[model samples]
Target: MNMSEWLVRTARRVPDAPALLSGENVAASYSEFAANAARIGGLLRTRHKVEPGDRVAIFMKNSTAYLELLYGVWFAGAVAVPINAKLHPREAAFIVEDSGSKVLFVSGAEELHSLLASTCTVHDIEAEPTFAAEGAAIAAPEPRAPDDLAWLFYTSGTTGKPKGVMLTNANLHAMTYAYFVDVDDVLAEDAAVYAAPLSHGAGLYNFMHVLRGSRHVVPLSGGFDAVELSALVPRLGNVTMFAAPTMISRWLTTARETGYSGEGLRTIVYGGGPMYQADIEAAVAHFGPRFVQIYGQGECPMTITSLSRSDIIDRAHPRWRERLASVGPAQSCVSVRVVDADGAEQPPSEIGEIVVSGAPVMKGYWNNPDATAQSIKDGWLWTGDIGTLDEDGYLTLRDRSKDVIISGGTNIYPREVEEALLMHPAVSEVSVIGRPNAQWGEEVVAVIVASTDRPPNPEELDAHCRSLIAGFKRPRAYFFETALPKNNYGKVLKTELRKNVSGL
Candidate 1:
């Protein structure tokens, strides 16, 4: 059950099927892709001495080569450890050392030679001699069991040091199946563009497309560029791309300037961070019924609830707005619940910690049993997200548990405050955080990115929030910036924001 087995199957079914693309041009066919993977797999076993359970890390950005190396490692029956390309060299090195990777593949080996003191062999994927030179292709991929570790994904260390989440072959198989049954369907004619970071959810989504022999597009920049996608999508018709909320916002801005109607764009599976109501509504109005929202974490690797295209565009339903704001019901394979601090199930409409138990949930954090036990209690992965579930089973996210502000003992979720601020005509993007106050404990403060040169004053935003939310929920202070600090996946760095606010 090595994940690369899917690539082999696609190659046999559609030898001539288009596989990888760079911009508008075809980079490899299905047969060619499989062949290259086999050869690379052979090289790993023969030359690099990678064993079945060994970890091989890929630290490169989005490219056809990245995918090739990823599958090649799996084909060799080794676990693929993908590092975020946006991380600092030191940070990437920590993951390499912690994962105990046998080899570290990178876009540039020279930069990491000094930073990484580990004995792991480093190879530049572009300059690897065996990628082009003579190498025996593996006749068949090494066998793997269902519980065998296929990927070791490290959580983004926004809170503390990253812990590797071990994802097994069975977990991935369930996630891929859930995509078709709950998420959007993929066609052989569809093209999946890698605009979001491949080390995250966007890369993990390659399974469904590969199973159907769909085309994969790696942007030349190896990252997001709305202008590039605006042109590329039309060139490659029937395109589907995973995006973060921030990327979607940038696309909306670019569409306004370029008048691009999202022609040839089939579906956008957006996740990785909280997508506010105002932003999602605006996207649907412009792009029509082409957006799907998924809510999951590194522990699950994108198999949670899915907000369907129909649910997103359904304006006629009596509860459409409320449903639209939700992440939809639990996906086919998982059981979701909202529970109180004492682990008791909360009634409908009561906010609590969201927990999930399913085939897709990670077995545990790699080499961190204590952390794993703390996170997954009684078989349910305690997703540190604060949310409420309605009677119909739709889950509405409030905010992260850490992001909740206890002002005068009244809990105020930042997402609620941000959503209210975004309702204002002048506000483009906003993040609300708690500023420590001596009297009231923690007071609400907003960090805003304005749409126009004339930013909304604190009084204007205060009045707008009052109409939409409770009096105490409105921000007591406002800080306007050109943009909010975000991670590679476009999640607002509230931890970083809080550090700055601590100074204020």
Candidate 2:
């Protein structure tokens, strides 16, 4: 079944419900939203000659029209390839050419049409969507099989160029079901805010809200703005938004400085990067029980594991803090394991490569059979993350396999060191990386972002590390900075940082 069927079904049940919004104002009702998608589908099939099984790319920022184009692609049984609007034109063009997309719908980036060197026809979303609203309508969505491709997601390439992960209709169905079972539940009165990029995990969350006939809101700022959100929430009550850890920290800071209480915001599902304990602890203390955590990569598409709202706020349990530090148990649709290199499962409390097998795993990488075979062994997809599983089934991430630093034949995880350093009063943010040493092979080093009120003393930080973690795990040196560099997704660019290590 095509995923667009959910939109059609909801429109039939609740034609007058709010379906799309721009800030606090409603842009389209459920009936109008579904009709717009059908007309856009007609434009794809009749005007652009897009057919079933073809790929259509969307390089757009968050907008009310973005959802229309996405469902429009699905209505025609074509695959949707959404690229981050922040990506360079060359990088976005590479994805368009590699996917062999039939058409590219661009928003916000006007120069894309002129600069894009691909054969795919480029359409300005601001203009084409208007034509779609008036064009002939498709009678119904094109039929799609369970295993047919639905979404093509590209991985963040820290090491090399990115590869496209192929997600099928069945895989998306499983992920949506898991969201209701393991993540937060959506209501018709709730509105999902698009603060993060619509090209990644936040975009994948649209299905549940659409299925329940809820409002899909794109902020007036087009992206995360603390002032915009704090004011918008009151107009549209019972709001939920997917956010990264850095966004949560920023939200907390805004709340503290302005005394803006979290009154209308319902929940913020945080993931896509490590949420250090100190950051989450402060967020929970300020916002009460409004945060949930999920752990997954592009391969699994946000269905691997989840730390629920109840578990996050359960301070009554003796091991609550330990559980809080974990990514929580395996979600309903998947089996997670920590395994050795030889594909054997590691015992409890031993760190190893984390692997998963389930309904939500992708079909494979697009047009790369060899890479697909290398990643998925037998029946399991070997996630490149390094982590351990405890006796009660909770999984704790150590670091990425490549990020693990070996010093004098002993492995040192950066999270352990970084977690310790963050507990200091003056330590605002920190990232840990290994520096090459002839004597020790690699020595642990810390990059600190100190608070404006009190800059940390290196000697005091060393004592703080001594009190929390092992001596050898402590940083051998420190570099103070105003901020660490991050990728578009808010993950610390350790690879970029490693390039500057010798000078630092």
On residues 1-504, what C-alpha lDDT tens digit does candidate 2 reach at each position? 999999999999999999999998899999999999998899899888999999999998889989999999999999999987766565677788889999999965665666667678888866755768665888889999999999999764333355899999999999999999999999999999999888988899999999999999999999988878888887788999998776777778888988877888899998876676877898999988999999988899898999999999898988888889999999999999999999999999998999999999999999989889988998899988999998999999987765766554344668767877888878899998998764455689999899866787889998888765557778999998889999899999998777878556
Report lDDT per candidate.
0.86, 0.86
lDDT of 1 at 244: 75
Clashing pairs in 1: none
Off by over 4 Å in 1: 129-132, 157-159, 403-504
What would the per-residue lDDT of candidate 1 be over residues 421-490, giving only the tens digit for each residue? 8888899999888877644556899899999989988888878776555577788888888989999999
Q: What is the TM-score of each candidate against the true structure?
A: 0.81, 0.81
Provide the global lDDT of candidate 2 against the true structure: 0.86
Candidate 1 TM-score over all chains jointly: 0.81
Residue 288, candidate 2: C-alpha displacement in angstroms: 1.0
Which parts of model 2 are misplaced by more than 4 Å?
A: 108-110, 127-129, 402-504
Q: lDDT: which candidate is best?
A: 2
